[model samples]
Target: MASSFHQFLLLLCCSVWYLTHISQSQSSPLPNALLLPITKDATTLQYVTKILHGTPLVPVNLVVNLGGPLLWTDCSSRFASSSSRSIPSRSIKCSREKAHDLGTKRTTCPSSAQPCEVSTENGITRMATRGELVEDIVAVGSIAGSKATVDQFVFSCAPTFLLNGLASGAKGMMGLGRTPIALPSQISTALGTQQKFTICLSSSDGILVSDQGPHDSVFGPEISRSVTYTPLFSLQEHSIGVKSIKINGNRLSLNASLLSSNGGTKLSTIVPYTTMESTIYATFIKAYIQAAASMNMTRVASVAPFGLCFSSKGIDSKQLSLKVPAIDLVLQSEMVKWRILGRNSMVRVNDEVMCLGFLDGGLNPMTSIVLGGYQLEDIVLQFDLGTSMLGFSPSLLMWERSCSDFKFDSWPKYSL
Candidate 1:
């Protein structure tokens, strides 16, 4: 099975390469010019940027998070006293009006306390304390290179963080949500540009973020177009509208109503970078397993965390390729269909075993789909809050592309 899967992936790659080559010859230039290096730390992807909290600048590693809106960093005494470049913590009176304006769920500022405790919806129990909203310079891309700086940026300075499942090396997270305090909005306001950012994740190389141009430029004739846009359901969580899911070409009789937002349930679809398996409704998983079984795929013993496993020992790569079926995510937009490639769906455990890179998300009533990083491999995702749309395209960069080529300080400059 492993050999067959590998062969299938190779065939798909060849076909895509041929198609991309032909398209590139006829198509215009790509809109994305500024490509910064991204580091893959285990399952999570991080982007490095310099933050000017004080006089001197400090290099901070931040995880690229799209689910939350607030940007914060650990403000422990060790971190603060280690470098003079660290932003100083200040106490400020909490305002009820401001708290109400920002919404209760976001603002953890107590009615009387100077230091605010903020909690994030990272699906974890971690909490971060906010010292005060300080004005600092945030440099994206590189410190010495053609980087964009957002001066007087209002971000929380959390002195401490109780984190789990996150890289300890990371100082904080760069929030890409649509809120006023989000990195995208702050950067857009500072640069006087549209609130837009692009994320390109690959199997080998990590994640790349690029500032997107105007809507006219993006959809115009001047820019080389490789992206397809779909209207975002909500900017708060960067949710996309998924209509249905299919195994190969056959559409499962899954309840579309369960996937829609109603009442207090906000059924969102997010692409998470910290996990390998895409979590879906348990019912959907059953349907998927049935589909695979129909294709003569032999089910093996269940692995921890994953419900489906298959024996791949002694199986020819080409044979596995011919046996496995394709999975397609049908979006709300009829014109767009995201087909899950082989490399994105299967994971090889050992020399003789492989498992589906998808899991049953339980029978929770909440409608949410977390598309894991594995599924997002080699895909470019563009979040455009200005146009209220999400764009996707095949990553132009190859998996074998070295991270050293696009180092933060050595990145090539391009005019916006």
Candidate 2:
């Protein structure tokens, strides 16, 4: 009888130990990659993410910008006074050395000036100015999960004009470029990880809740194996080399010399906010039109800004029998080809009209190929600062399943 009781007790103890081990493993910190659900406004292609800033933690929605080097938000009187959780911007002196290091011309400041004025250009044509720089606490990730908070975090308090123009509805912008003042640098230091981060923007329609990962972050270790990496050129610009571009299977006769950044030509791979040079855009449109023509597709009258438009009066974008040619952006190597699908390359302007998304960047004189955000929608972009490499893969959410049916726990199985 005593032996039977001892055996039962041992079995119970072993079961408890197994359960405890499983729980501890489940609670472990997530890998280096942090995945967040990016929210795109219905009217615009810009992607926004949420972050808590300041002492009491005011939730600020910021645009995830890859082309700028400064993290800033609107600090106007209205924004400061409205929220009880809002932390007022404090005054700080701007030194000549500091301005130079920030990649801007040194401005003359008087000794009596409490808030130093500094201005920097954004990814687009907008110029934002900060009247003062202040230190505050910033919390990243979710409040319920493994969150990182940095005390005495420094950022800009932009002028009313800049705030109103650039980030009107949103709080401000979160710059992801390779600058000392960028958000990635600050977050890397706070997390004690290498200065690295990845972005997996889902193009899936509808609202997406945070995934059920252990750390409650995006792009964790489970998805790492699926990423294909390419070397990143120009740290500040985050440009990658493009060997050639092919429409369908035929390659265009492009002048490689004109594409180079040599001499006075400012041509380079830029993740522009919007628009591309007329010359570059024209070439792509011509080839795309040719491909569509071959497919016996009829083109309707051109819209004002869009060079190409198709009548979708009878059929929806998904049901249209149009065979839009696949655009292959051959990167530094022939093996690395980034394919832009028809759904992404074409924009649905209205219920009856679908237009080419590429715009003429004739306004800007500099010869450049700007890869707008629309081209990158629904793609997972991984920026590795430590190795100066950019990795990308199609989002797993591209399957036929609805967004609500996505299971985060089974993400690894769907990785391409």
Candidate 3:
């Protein structure tokens, strides 16, 4: 039965992958297929026995065939699959029955009638003791590694609102305002700026903020009652790659560290906001900032106020680690995968990471209509570096463009 179940899952996964990401032609809307969590449990747990965990195990070796007006590196590309390999284990478990349909095996509550919400605040999702993601509710999806670059794997799939009270583990979302999904102007009246204030808003699906204040606040306020502005997903900031440009004759670099896990993680750098690296990275960070300047990207000025702080080698090559701020998520990138090296150790490589960060409405403006707001894809990913191997997500590699195979290429063309 175990062998049959495993084989069934493998086949289901293959079918889902091909149907979602591939087609006879490439012009169709980008595929919405996403990564789901797979839980493996041991037969027993001793009083002092080590807890087992599960890590991302994406064995897909995808070769994207990029061709068209789109820039290969610009978040849209095809994916190829590869052979299967085992990843690390953790203290996650599920019923043997739930493991039967591996491809569609989502974490759900014990009732199986209720759904689970992926906790964006801590980058972790709660599952039934059986280790199942509540079907349809909200649950974080697992990824392959400890550290991930959100920019890489964010632009893969489209998220389903699943009004049936179920939302897919998606990527690329953002928090527009405080809670109401209203514009800054509307919220200002309620909170009264410079005053400690809070308002009520609807609960976020996979694309909005999870109001930590109160679930009943929606019916409490008048001005706050009406959700305004259509909840726009605005552009935050843009930065250029340090390697692509030079500052003070030194290659520029942007280092992001998780500052606090309050609403989400606030990524800050070690350098104060007025350094060279910050200037350079910020200069080229925008999607269309280059086109707006009409200047050779290498020659653009590093004048973005947000790029005030810059650091050279902020993160050491030997070992670089940062904390992920606790914030509600919109969605997570699916292309990236991870392996757990440690489980619940709270130490380097032996930590628990549960979530996938994918590109979403925040970066790809086109997805906003469906996502309905600024979205950031954060899924539950379990990882412990103690007994895991390094894995890579296709999204992490630089995007390439070609009429043929769309592998990572050094030079990808862009149109203004």
Tell me the tens digit of each residue's lDDT in model 3 across 216-272: 221122222322211111122111111122222222232221111111221111111
Q: lDDT scores for all predictions? A: 0.54, 0.57, 0.19
Worst 10 residues of 3 by lDDT: 65-74
Native-structure RMSD, model 1: 12.8
Best by lDDT: 2
* Model 2 residue 335 lDDT score: 85
Best prediction by TM-score: 2
Regions of model 3 farther than 4 Å from truth: 1-249, 253-403, 406-416
lDDT of 1 by residue, 157-220 (tens): 6544443445557666666666777777777777776777766555445434555533222223
Models 1 onward score TM values of 0.71, 0.75, 0.17
Score candidate 1 by TM-score against the native: 0.71
